[model samples]
Target: MTDETRTSALQILRTLVGSPTADFHEGQYEAISSLVDGHSRALVVQRTGWGKSAVYFVATLLLRQRGGGPTVLVSPLLALMRDQISAAERAGVRAVAINSTNAHEWGDVVAALERDEVDVLLVSPERLNNPTFREQQLPALVARMGLLVVDEAHCISDWGHDFRPDYRRLRDLIAQMPSGVPVLATTATANSRVVADIAEQLGGAEVVTIRGPLARASLRLGVLRLPDSKTRLGWLLSHLGDLPGSGIIYTLTVSAAEDTARLLRDAGHAVRAYTGQTDTGEREESEGMLKRNEVKALVATSALGMGFDKPDLGFVVHLGAPSSPVAYYQQVGRAGRATENADVLLLPGTEDRDIWQYFATASMPDQARAERILSALERERPTSTPALEALVDIRRTPLELLLKVLDVDGAVRRVQGGWVATGEPWTYDAERYSRIAAERVAEQQHMIEYETTTSCRMEFLQRTLDDETAAPCGRCDNCAGAWYPTAIAADAAASAASSLDRVGVAIEPRAQWPTGADRLGLPVKGRIAAAERPLEGRALARLTDLGWGGTLRELFAPGSPDAPASAALIAACVRVLAGWGWKERPAAIVTMPSRRHPQLIESVAAGLSQAGRLPHLGSLEYLKGGPEGEPGGNSAYRLAGVWGRIGVPDALADDLAGLAATKPDSPILLIDDLVDSRWTITVASRALRQSGAAGVLPFALAVVR
Candidate 1:
């Protein structure tokens, strides 16, 4: 960056250092400026305190200044909404939060919003659900919603950091909006899956992802492996030794937060702790006092979030590892907001890992079984606690998770009277049957891959679960290490054209998994690569790839052989692969939508050959915006595919080292669909050559529109 940008960034960092938040870095401002200046929607998949709120806040200001429609910040909490409104007011923007909890003020807020008088409209999803907001004011509110800012957006994804039903309903909310009012989503932490899911849910908006650097150059990151609570408490007191400004200590449980706060206060340090379960007046008093510096440290549960913006918080001490890395990142991120040299103390207790893993790897009750259990409870009338326990294998805790899901889906209700099924009886049984077999198999396969793979641990993870499709993933653990793909000793006994002989294989003898089977532990099997009906899933996939022709029923019919042999042959291979812990389902395969290849094809082809995951990357769309973004293709896959058709080696995977050695003008070409962000391909290819490929190339269908 230029001197001006650098100077401004450091100044902001300096200004916010003593407050209690660790956001407002130079990089955050630059990223936010770039995104707002671009005037487009983006997914901010950043860690906490990377100034995510400031980004949206600044974007709102810019849009207002530019006469954009009233910026709608869809915050989840009423308190957070009010805070944003207050912040905006501090900057002199006409911000208002339409919280109708009081009922009396609801109409006034609605009328103000209808007239587009509000510059930024912050409202909870529940507020949006009201009949008044839905039927009257909501319908007309969108044309004025030039910037649809979805704050804390992950609640929408089932696989998000935190899943809430109200959040999922926002999908319908966006669908109800007036067209062309671009939606911009901001979140403190989102992984790769969350990123793709966000883009997909947001109606295919281009992802202007700003991955804030995870390193806090100024903050000292120290993880103390504590043996017990006594030692951890001692460490905390020692660290607190007269660092004047302020610090925040986080605990996983409300009781812990309270106890810690109590002990610290008793020891003569002004301390405060807050939990979601804390009483209203007491909670307010605690927060207010903490903010005023009456309390030198605030011990809090994970219940705190983006609403509070305190700069210059000197340090953040964690009692233990959080539920997820994302949580830890966001919490520590709250520290050093203004401290150029801030510190993050991560006390990953030994018990923390085991405790957290108990939740993570616990055998989840079958989704269907849980649904049925609740349905039974609902239909048969609310039974007594003992009666309910006796009727089913469930206890209160796991039941609570599913109950939460059911509650969100509006499938169940809790009344003073008892639990009752609400809304229509959603038919989960049909969907359940369609998934069970495949889900079991797929999950097993993923486990097998992870445990069996000879490749770099980071590489396997990045590719298998993380799915970083871009050519260059230099920042990942895999890109930093050597890769050694396992040479799965292909049993040469079975020739390529030989039938998958299944002679003497147990027909229904047993369902026992073999030794290595435990390793491939994903949830689904075979993706139904070739199913018996509807003919859409893995069934269509296998047929298309194997270059076979037949109806789904006929193919799966009893006694029918696949391709060149008997059903027995193919069944044998399935058994063998299963025993070896191969993915019971066919791996994710692909087909390009562009059946109409250009006679005088539009692609620039060179050095493109598919390999590694090249085959899985699917087809490249040769479009300058005719259509983009299918179920599987992202800009990364689209780029690789376009390069694939350009006569580049199809083995065009994410190995940057191999691609960098190519001569610039050689006949060898690398092609992709298009370059919305040329940096992905450019970086990928640069790394490949850096590894050792000398005959590399570049090609694509079109430049991004």
Candidate 2:
């Protein structure tokens, strides 16, 4: 590199960080120089807050100064893109991003790109597959692209902790880029296998990798094995204020995140819940609040994991262990980035493995389901996801994932309207998928060992990531004795127990029939008739709740004895009814015919009937031997399977008619053991309402979340 090039890069770095004395970290300058001067692909695998972004930003400015075209950067999340845009402004570089949230600004962004006004253009990997963008904007951008940057590059490798199928599209993007265009892939968490995989994808034997030690000296790690969820909540309620500065508290599920936030706020702590379910505007607001220390913490799920940049974050506490040590390391790495010391604690629960197992297999495609989808698309026409759901029973999420995998493998193509087959012969790679599943199991076991290991926690995590610089940090709880309090105040424990003991979740009735029901030979379409709709109902609790969730999971677990509702559960059902606050009391009780848990449903209905003095009406008869489809399917398929399968029996219909004549305003309480898709409740409630009941109030023991 020439002296002038080095001098200019250093100046840009100082301006980017707003520090006159700021210089490159150990490998930052080398990575930048390789990309800018050598014009070659480079991969930087370093710990979090190690200035990985600096390499790309500096390289971008240099390439632009040499009269190169705008740099194209592929980032994973909107939060990350927002942060990078702000950093680019600090360095006097114009950065624009095109994502789902900013459809209104695409025209201006494209104009700016055409005018050669953009310095860096940030886009998500998913955007690469957009029919319009790929056909209209991508070709021009690739033709003159000066540099390409892939942030969170670990996601590209299937062996990585968080593998995303969209990232696999980057291989084709790289192959189509002009030959001299420098490419940089950066990540904070990657073991040897993932690193090699990403490097091979970038360009085997041609991609230069600059790796550094994965240890974060500023983080003090520890683990606390709590007995149960209640105690964990109590610990937080008692000691959250004791953690140094505003930080994050991670949970395994969205319900847990919201529940924890509520309990902590009731204890007078300023906190907010963040999850994938949170509105985009609210998520952005919460991110700002955490960055400015306006709130004590953001109770969040993995949705808040990547692309969030908080330099002085004080601590991170996990309510449950993540499934893998690599994932845990990435989450904890968020803390102590630019501070002298930040506390990291894990309060693992006994149910952690159960939660892990629930999510572990969700991403893998099923061979039978894949073949069914392919066969459906063989008709040579476009089929939207909802329409396709009527043809095949896969749920929306896993179906989308399968389509992306098929798209990458050349088996199918997602066009403007929907998806179409490529007529390419595709075989299920059972060997590869099974190996990946086995790796996941191994990772879960390692996470358990991490929670109980007597060795240094930081060292254990570093070694888990295959860092050669792993050693005792001498600052973790195991190394220097526990730095956090273990005792939970009696009052705090009582408060937590009370919160957990509380039950009742509102069951919002489905307002509209799913689109494409006609494709399944059902006449339903558009908005459901208001008169046929069930009144707002209640469930004892969500299957994912921290408190009642555990009990419900055990009661409804696969292979569990199909017995009557226990006394405690019956009492809980009464509590839910007591707090329902319905405008008018239910005039009678009815149960949905259940194939799996008839005893449980009947017992609950009978108990509620005896307690409330309401007559128990017979269950709705199953017309076709109960609902056909199993649990866990898309709305369209679920609704189709149960559409006409439930009918009001002759005796039940007559009794409801008589009750309606006596009390025209009262509703019939319909009970069930569990509510998954809510289609069964909808179908049954419509039958009751049509059979003379003024309204139907659906009640369930648990609602699947």
Between which residue pairs do clashes occur in model 2? none
- Locate the minimum summed-lDDT window of 10 residues in model 1: 532-541
The whole-model lDDT of each prediction reads 0.49, 0.91
Over the stretch 243-317, how does candidate 1's per-residue lDDT look in tens digits?
A: 447778888656457666766675577888787777656766766676677778888876665555566677777
> Which residues of candidate 2, in runs, are more than 4 Å off?
160-163, 378-380
Q: Taking the tens digit of each residue's C-alpha lDDT, what string does model 2 give over 298-344? A: 99999888768898999999999899887888888889888999999
How many clashes does each candidate structure show, in the order listed?
83, 0
Q: Which stretches of candidate 1 lie over 4 Å from their true place?
A: 1-39, 46-50, 61-68, 77-79, 98-107, 130-137, 158-163, 357-404, 407-705
Residue 161 lDDT (model 1): 16
Worst 10 residues of 2 by lDDT: 157-166
Candidate number of the best lDDT: 2
Candidate that would win on TM-score = 2
